[model samples]
Target: MTTDPLHILKTVYGYDAFRGRQAEIVDHVIAGNNAFVLMPTGGGKSLCYQIPALCRPGMGLVVSPLIALMADQVAALRQAGVRAAALNSDLPPEERRDLWRAIGEGTLDLLYAAPETLLRSGIIDRLRNIPLSLIAIDEAHCLSQWGHDFRPHYRQLDALVDLFPDTPRMALTATADAPTRGEIVAHLQIGNDDSFIAGFDRPNIRYAVEEKDNPRRQLMRFLQNHENESGIVYCLSKRKTEETAAWLQDQGYNALAYHGGMDKAAREVNQTRFQREEAVVMVATIAFGMGIDKPDVRFVAHIDLPGSIEAYYQETGRAGRDGLPSEALMLYGADDIALRRRFIDESDAPDTRKRMEQQKLDALLGLTETAQCRRQVLLNYFGDACSPCGNCDTCANPPERFDGTVAAQKVLSCIYRTGERFGQAYVIAVLLGDEDERIARFGHDRISTFGIGKEHDQRTWRSILRQLIAHGFIHVDLAGHGGLSIAEAGRRFLREKPVLMLRTPPPAAKGRKGRAARGGVPVSLDQTDSALFNALRDKRIEIAREQNLPPYVIFHDKTLIEMARTRPANRADMAGISGIGEAKLDRYGEAFLAVIAGHQPDAG
Candidate 1:
């Protein structure tokens, strides 16, 4: 029953060294031990379970929750010369039966099934007779009630874990706060002997948060800086997802929208394109991000706030996945806080659950408005000490702030003079002395405060107003009441006694020609083989068109780009490209050799 333990790591896995704690975790798992790993997206979590699967005797039962999770991970494993298979409701009965037969015959080394599969009547009954080696749970936070994402079916996994207690368990998650970590152990009843970890710091990713103005324009500028790099934008609602995607596409990026509303086939197509193509920006709701395996995404930008800090970390963790320097930008406003509170308060959960939900919302708000460095804010949430990452926009392009107590006093005075009963646009109009029709109708142009703020442009004044609201010096009237009201903090400003500082409105976020890399990265492209890569790509496309499948199905554009950049000259070298499947190298791979042999110019 014993096997050489480290062979898989060096041979089939193709990695010479373990990333972070992979070697230690693999040692534990191969010794019939348990582990709880909290690695980030590209921290090599898969290999910890995968190498052990090959080293153990029976099939490794990986209980994943999503259909796409099973399919993507299984595809990647099978491509890596591992015998892996997945069973899910998405497949027809015939294919399901075929997978079962393979499992029964011991032909499968690893198997992926949804948690709901264990609930099927005869399936669990039959599964009891099969020999099980270990159970690995991905995205283990779903089991926690306090977790932002709670799945009822995942909560039921405890019963299943109790039934198979003898099999060693390892729970792996990309992101989990302390509360969720405790829940994972308690829900699974993991033994005290199991390992628990936080993980390594990817110091390459620069984190930044900008107070909201025109968020769309700001995002456009961020994209322009990382021109021709992969990124993602997460929106809270489906409508915003579609609009942002359409807007980016209009600006000439290959952007795609995905949400739960879309048909399954469309989501799959968009996801496949993002994985295989270059410079694609995917705009999606939260539903689209789980289990996507693409590794080189350069940034994750958020237009709206996520429900919790854990969700934000995991979502942004999708970027900088190849150990390259990347960006995580968030544009937040006070409206986002109100929206989150509305969502949580309106949910049908019990009173206790709603109270917990409020704490989560408060945490997100604190993150948005943190006075400290962005990395310091993030690491503190996870119980770690971190220094200021001197590379973010906050550090690189430091804001110039001036004392604004006088200006705040004037704005509040105008609100009072106008009867304190107008929304932002109207208030701004009266202060700026704009004799627009609304101003005349309200007779606000005749007020004493009118024409006083005319020294500043309308946009600049609005940014100041927004910052005031965010700082809690002023508050928006709720319940369809449209005017601004002075909060308790605003009283200090109105009393002409407090010193408040305000940043200048940031630059318009568009039309940057090129953004030189801020820090920590030297080059964008691998220098060794850029030319030969193009020739191989042409051959791939010609063959793909002849075969009638998508070009990526033959070989991803990423693989071709890497091939040219790395200039691999032999079969073994070609196999190292990330997207090259085994069946692909067996076919159409030799054609790439002629190009690599000489730096052939791409065919005209």
Candidate 2:
């Protein structure tokens, strides 16, 4: 009757109002009902379990895949004054036993563990003895054979649901197509549990796709669009990860590479460095995205196409977690698909696995080929209805598609006139009326349509080629190596009629630095007391150093920056910054106030 949930939310978690159905989901879990939560990246999935853990009489057992993810979540929870600990391989036996004792003694409210360990002998019974109230599965889709990221350990987790049938359980994921969702429920053996689908509209995440050409340079250019913001760039290979990280460092960006190929200790070091350090961009492969709990990542870029749309959605969801505007840019080519296909085809996976892999590949192909609003296509796969995001590249810049009957003739004529023996660059040069050495050597200057489309610039011609390939209007002969061949769509465009809507490239990003200019925390009030903010941050670091704790343990970068801007003169005014909870305010409040008072009087 008193809305105890609202009181708990504001006082315990510091959120004045619930985001979306977070309060409802917590209410459901607290009511002792099993729930399946399908929320987007920033959708507050943790609260479903965390809040329930606090409300329920006993501890909650959270099954998670990544140790770093579990550790980060535990760190954040403990920071907010919750009692949490993690059991993982990284913990020494002494520490693991101590943690187990804490859980048994009821000193811990939540405990996180990997499935591999949970499935180990005697762990389930040990958990039963601790009076667990709920069992939550994070990244629950990994149980799906239909998913890109399936784990045998997750298959073993189904045993837990049967063991704790009476106990309410929650399974959560960010990206699960319908098939994967069904697999998660069935695999978890919670077929009758309620499922909640938070809207998949990552409205704050602007999605864009760029055709691959000098992908590393394109990545650099793209990062420049959102400069100085923290982001993640996913690559297909470890070599590229290292190289890209190095190149970004050369350009004066704080970048680091992470991959499975590295030593375990080294990977852990880099991951810690990234998590604890602010504005450190981690260039890693798919492995890096899975267990990360960093909430402030402003962008996610794929230097290569993810293996499936499911994978793509999950990777991109990692951005915009703070619910502010963010960007997800994918630079892809057919070769990326082929490489993953080759890996799958050549692997020793069983025939069933191969078939599943093929189906996943087909879904990705459908996504790439469809000219429909990408948001519509992406959401449709999840059985959700959404209008075109109107902000995506496809919707905003409606490509100037012609009934390629004319330009196709120009393209095909240039190809035909030059005997069709060239790659895209030479062909584009011919179309652009470039009288270069290559054109003369190939005698393309003598072609009929050589200068016909001089009205269009080279970039426009390139975009046309990209759309042609994307729209099935042209084919790049992978076997002919790099030669362009007219496909049936191209033939139709040339002889019959094919409408092509050309998409205009977005304008250049302009901002303070070379980083991405698109996405970040809102510049609502110009939080740029840069000198004062820097000074406050220095004080926070000095205090953290003196206390021998991580800087975040004192106050996160965001909290310190907020104090610098608000310049709150008193304790009451200091309480409004995000992440500055009562405990943090009481512990470090006076110091922050002293710094702010030293700078100036109350501005807010």
Candidate 3:
């Protein structure tokens, strides 16, 4: 057996070389140094630890927070010819005993355990006796209190450091800003210089944020472009997720609803269906996306605003993980802003945490409202510098901005004149000189700000209001019935009449030119290669069904695309493909070559 990291990477995982910083990370771990790795979701993070586990002497222990994550990783690793297993609640007692025996006998190359399971006295006592090559904490950001996925059990992971002191330890996460990164490092007790931060940019994902107008209609239009592709639609509420899934089903799409509100069996079934089948759309709340290993998700659409930029980044990062072209579209409005603000403000968190949460929201809003390149603004938030990507909505067609000093003063004056206790609809009603009964009862019709904003219609006023909220010129009283209150910045703007540059909301998505609407990410195959790719994919699905595994576990779409493009005629040619390792080649290479040569494999 090869004990070299590079040889293991190629022979087991089937990649010819390390990408970006994987080699540096693997070498550091193999050399017996503690490391912290922050790579993007699809950046091949598993290789950093997986290769080292093969090169090093003993079993690799991975502390995972989710049972599904552990199961998925173990399955994928085992498929890649690594002897991986997980001790989780799903395993029967007999099976657990068998796995324990395997671990004790040193027959497993990698072992994954949920955080709680790892902390069990029986498990730790056994692990202490076994020779350990390394300890890896996946999704290490869950240990940070500042993160959205905080798990109490993750805090207990510090015990692993003492229990396996001689084993090289590493913590890995796909999402973390500077503060969260520091917390993970401190909690793991890794030195600052040992941390590796690969570029967080997922260049394959084309980002598009649109103003919410006729939201269902907007989502429908967006879906038109993504027809027959695997994707996710994230709604803020449980009811919305179900409704969206039902509506999509009514439209002839294979849509499923998944959220915390469902029965455990139902949720698992829906998740399984989405993972195993192609072109299944999962309409879910924020609860649906972590540890999802599906690699060909073509799009991620947000029907509502995420709580923070980090949440947004991580959710969207789930798409295009296989490095194929993908799209992320968010339809946001004033109500989303208000609901998210209320969620943060009404939480039991301390004052400092609330302030931090508010700042993160503001950053997301800034990205949504920016007239500059969306990718540039998004990357800047993570402290990664990049040029205008020309692959986002703004770069494809920049929004027009106008000097809104007069408009801003008018909006602020309207808010101030209305006693600052009214909701957005009422304020817009007053601004538009509408004389409804509520307006009459409140006597807001007589205010000086009444009819002042009539030059721009109601829709225009709503857009301006949402932008103002995003810019921090106004705050929403979500707990108090979604009232709009002017902020200090609004007061200053009103007093000084500073020029406010506001972007005109982009036009509704036309869903034209297919993927071109999504900044032209390459999501399709040409006519000549499309047939072969589909044939290969059909074969992959057939084998996956026979084995009861997700199609991606056999080979990702990118790998299939390479096969179709290259048309490999023999096992050696197939082995040269990116994901076709020696184990895979030995297992199914001849069958694939047979397909390429236009013959069916024997059914025997």
Candidate 4:
């Protein structure tokens, strides 16, 4: 067995080198020191602990939060020929017995358990006898009360330090701002000096935020380019998830709905099908995406605004896990913004927590309404400096901004004139001179602000309103039936009449040209190589189905692309590919070699 992390990485996991801080973190762990890692998804955070576990003396204990995540990690590790097992409530009795036997015999290289399961007296007793090389708390942000995915059980994990006094511990998460990061460190008892913060920028993901107008049609248009690709469409409500899933199914697309409201068996089935099949779209609420391990999800679309920047980053991080080009689009309306504000105000959290959450929401809203590069704004939130990425929507079709002091004044005047008691729809109706009975009864049709905004359409005015709310010039009054109310900034803006520059949304694309306008994935392979890649993909899928495993567990698309480009001919040639580990070469080299040599069994 190789003791060198680099050698173990190549011979087992089959990667050439560590990415970013992976090598540093691995060395820290191998030296029997603790670590704290914050790396973006697809940044290979797992290798930091996995490599060290293989090089160290005993099995690595991974504290997983979800059963599905645990199973997925164990499967992937086993496929790489590492001795791994996940002990969870989902395991059959016989399987649990076998896992315990393996643990007692010191036969496993890694063991994954949820926080609740690991804290049990029985499991704790067993772990005390078994030597642990290192303990890795995956998704450590869950321990933070300030984090979006806070798990109560995770708070008890501080006891791990006391129980395993001699073992080095690592805490890791993908989405944590400074406050949340500090909370994670404190809760996990990890040293602050050992923290490794990788850049939060997922450069491969093209960020696009479109003002909502005809949202269903706009979503369909965006999905056109992603046909035959796996993606996720996030909705704010469970009802929306079901409706979107059904509507997409009616449109001849394979779609599934997932949410916490669904039956456990049903949700599990949908998630399983999504993982096992290709090109499946999952329309889901916020309940679906924590600790997901799917690597080939090509896109993630948001039909509504997410609550906070942290939640948005963590959710969008689900796409393009294989380092391939992927896209994320957020379609939000003024209504969505108001609704999110209402939800925040109505939450049972403490005043300080709510204030922090409100700040986070403001940051995300600022990103959506800004004319600057979306990537820069997102990275800046994580304290990472970024240049304008030419791949995002704002970069491809930069929106124009104009002096909107008059528009801002007009919006403020309308709210003031309407008694600040009406919601955005009624307010917009009054602005657009709609002859609604309510507007007439409230005498809003006679107000000086009525019809003054007819120069731009209703959509334009709504965009302006959202920008105002985002900038803190206005706020939603949840107690007043989701009505719009002027904030201190709005009063100051009206009195000061500052020059307000608001973004002018780009005109909607009329045809299939939208994809080209959005800047697509760079093709790395020529036509001939591409065809070979598809053939290799088919073979991998067939093998995956036979083994009852996700295709990526066999080999990621990145690995297959390399194989197609090189066109390896024999065992030696196959072994040279980036993802072909020694174990995989012995098990699959001959089959993949045959496929590359034009002897594919299924290429009739």
Candidate 5:
């Protein structure tokens, strides 16, 4: 029952020091002040509130967005020997009564509930009578309409400020741009000096984008490097998710499909398997990954382009949450770009919102098409900057550039000559002098720009057109079924003839040869250590199965990797490992020490 933060951190969470701005934010809340925290995923955000709650006198009330996330956090806290419980619809009546009894007796340290549950009349009335340590709003960005994932229920949480006038309030989120940040601060009434923005950077993640040429083969190549690892494959449609999962399953992968179209019970089952098993790959649409707390996802692949950079960042941030190496590969094409634009143009949002969405989409396209460092562009979007990170694909293999003034001019003139009423396929066909009946009927066969771009192949022309759209030299006509039209920039390019450099079309896929072809964040263990790591994982899985909990809830892969390398022989040595708190050391130290003692290294 100590109130010292550092003492609590070392003995309770087993961390030697706080990461980044966690200590400052934690101290601010502990001093009975409201603060807004913007830290990246896996940046130890939970500690900013959890530590303060432990140091204060009363129970901490956490507002989370998902039931699964709440349950996982409660389980992890319980493992650390903290009194934590979650209130949700899934809890049985008897269990709910028990939790309420503990609350009445001042035995619970932290309580997690969804925003909807907290706003209920009975729940609010009961909570008002108790002493509150802090009111924490996780995923606070959901309160803003400008955020990628907006929930109407979150907007109602502003009442907490009035209901608990004297208690400290903290709002935390991992993904929020300037506008979204502003909206959150205004709605929550956070003080200007109290806002702390730990920069939005996950340096362990390697970013790579490839043109969609035989997407299945490209995805397969990416998957080869991540064998038997947990990951997510994002698609744009429910049917595509199911198809991709089935295809991966056919190819001997443990893949599952998830989307809004699936039955609720079926979705729950699939999600459970994904959480409990180590190697499950969830092929899902945007519906699958808002509040997933899985810590060891090694990769995230996108078969289609996401709507904006915010969505992409939030989705990819789900990987490598345990701070190990991870990869994010996105397969994009001109068609994906067109489809995304059409979705924006066809939506019923107001003009201002649509324009903002378009701008966001444009920023994402810039990131995808940039010949410079990918990390630079991504960080710059969130008003942060970094030097050329050597981890991204562009830094590993810099794209070759060529003067593309003529190519730009030819594409622009073709769109105009064809009356600006054709999509990329037809425009590229006219450029390459194809013998299609549509081109013949349009009499574009005799156009002056016809066959001018035949020097480049179809893939090359597709690349060129996609860059044009991304750069704002051209615009998509949603009314004309994604026809191309010249923007003012394109008109200026034609009139003024500026020098333009375009990236060379990447070479044809050679298919990854083996593990030797892997790049970006080397694997943590060598051959001998890998065998021991596997053995430790097997032991963890066995224990987790017996306890009916996810293996990560038992111990993260990072902890197991540490054990494998250090070969902790006894309880004292095991307790010195990073994640092994006093409680876990008492609960699991002997078992893990036995694992290390029993392992037999390969002789070869």
Candidate 6:
């Protein structure tokens, strides 16, 4: 085997060059150093450790969090003709014995195991005798309590440092804020100087957030453009996941549901179908998509707001993992915000942790309410910046803003005079001077603030209230009856009479429209190329079915697009295409080349 990292990259992984700081991180690890890597999803993070492991003498041990993630990575590596295996409870006892035999013989290039398995008494004792090239901890952010997805088992990974004192260790994660990064480094005992902080940016994804007026309709409209494409629809509750999946199926979509509440076998079947099939929509709760390896998910839509910016980033990052054009759509309303806050307040965490969680939620709310470029706000949350991206919803359709101080004051005053115990609908109705028995019974109809808010419509007033909640000027009584009350900031605002600007509620969407009608990102392939692309996908699916693997494990859509356009003619030409390594060239070069050749003009 070649000891050169670049050589292994080209001949084994089939990439012509290293991306970003891959080469630097690989060299540092090869030199027997510890480092932490922070790169976006689909940023080629695996190569940072894989190359060094291949170049070094002993096998690499990767600590993964999920059995499915381990299986997927091992499959992809073996497809590239590398010796990789995963040890988890999913494996049969016979297969486990075989893997251990291979490990004893030093025949494996990489071994993946969960932290719990690695920390087992006899397991660590046995591995201590074997030579280890490096210890890689994937999804390293789980070790940090400050991270969005914290696992107590991951906190025990620090023991690996003392157990393997001489071996290089690398911690890698796709989502981590500044605090989370600090916690991860401190927990893993990695030197501060050894950290490589790659900027967090997934430019291929278009960000869009809509007010949750008609969530089902909004989601349907968003799905129109993604017809016959694979995606994930995230819900906040298990029952919602099942209901949403059923509703989508009624609409003639291949939809499935997944959540922790389902039976274990049912959950696995749904996940397997989602992985193996095309054009399937998986409606799931937050329990899904922690370590999903599917690279062709064209979109991720959230029917409910997530808890924090970190959670939002991690979930949305699952889309567009193949460097292709994808989208992230979120529908949020006052109720979602209130429910999220209630979750935080009701948790058993200390006040400091609750405050931290609240701040994170506030940041997310700010992102949802910002009129600036969504990408800029999102990137800035992670202490990164970028020029205005023309892809997000804000950049495409800039919302109109108006002076809303009087409007805000009217709503706040009404909440106060009405005893601050009514929901938004009743409050808006009172402001609209609706001659209802409930309002007259409470004498809210006579309040001075009631008729004063008649200038703006209910939608406009709702927008103002949402923004006020986001701005910390109002608090939601989620624990009681979802009522609204003025916060300290709102009191100060009424006293000081400061200028306040709020986004005008966007006009109701006219009708159900497809992506083209909504000015969505155009398909990358043209008419002629699309035919060949379709043919290549058919071939890929056929090969995948035969091998009992997901289609992407055969080749990514990006690779197929290149094949269709460039029309590589032979094995050597196919080897030059990205993702086509030497082993794959020998196995699949002719099959793909034939498809391309048949689609040529002269050949027809």
Residue 518: error of model 1 in Å?
Answer: 16
Name the Cα RMSD for model 6.
1.8
lDDT per residue for candidate 3 within 541-604, as digits (tens), equals: 9999999988889988888889878888888789999998888888889878877888222221
- Give per-residue lDDT, candidate 4, residue 171: 93
Give me the overall lDDT of model 2.
0.75
Model 4 clashing-pair count: 0
lDDT of 4 by residue, 1-604 (tens): 7899889988997777877889899999999999999999989988888889999998999998889888889999998899999988889999999999998898999999999999999889989999999999999988999888899999999999899989999998899989889988886678878899998999999899988888889898888888778889999999999999999999988999999999999999999889888889999998897757988888999999998888899999999988888889998877787778778788998999889888888898888987889999998998998889998888988889988889888888999999987878888888889888998888888889988888778777877888888788888876668788899989998888877898986676565355442212224566667777877889998999999998888988888888888888788788888888988888788888888889332453
Range of the 10 consecutive residues with the lowest summed lDDT in candidate 3: 514-523
For every candidate structure, what is the RMSD over all alpha carbons to the true structure, in angstroms? 4.4, 4.5, 2.8, 2.6, 2.2, 1.8
Weakest ten-residue segment in model 1 by summed lDDT: 518-527
Give me the displacement of residue 25 in model 2, in angstroms.
1.4
Candidate 3 Cα deviation (angstroms), residue 406: 1.5
| Best candidate (score: TM-score) | 6
Query: In candidate 3, which residue pairs get closer than 3 Å at backbone N, Cα or C atoms, i.e. clash?
Result: none
TM-score of model 3 (CA atoms) = 0.95
Clashes of each: 2, 16, 0, 0, 0, 0
The TM-scores of all predictions, comma-separated, are 0.84, 0.83, 0.95, 0.95, 0.96, 0.97
Model 5: per-residue Cα lDDT over 470-489, one tens digit each: 78898887666888899998
Better of 2 and 5 by TM-score: 5
Q: What does candidate 1 score on TM?
A: 0.84
Instruction: Indicate the TM-score of model 2.
Output: 0.83
Give Cα distance to truth, residue 271, candidate 1, Å.
3.1
Residue 448, model 5: lDDT of 99
For candidate 5, what is the total of clashing residue pairs?
0
List candidate 6 segments past 4 Å from native: 511-514, 517-522
| Candidate 4 residue pairs in backbone clash | none
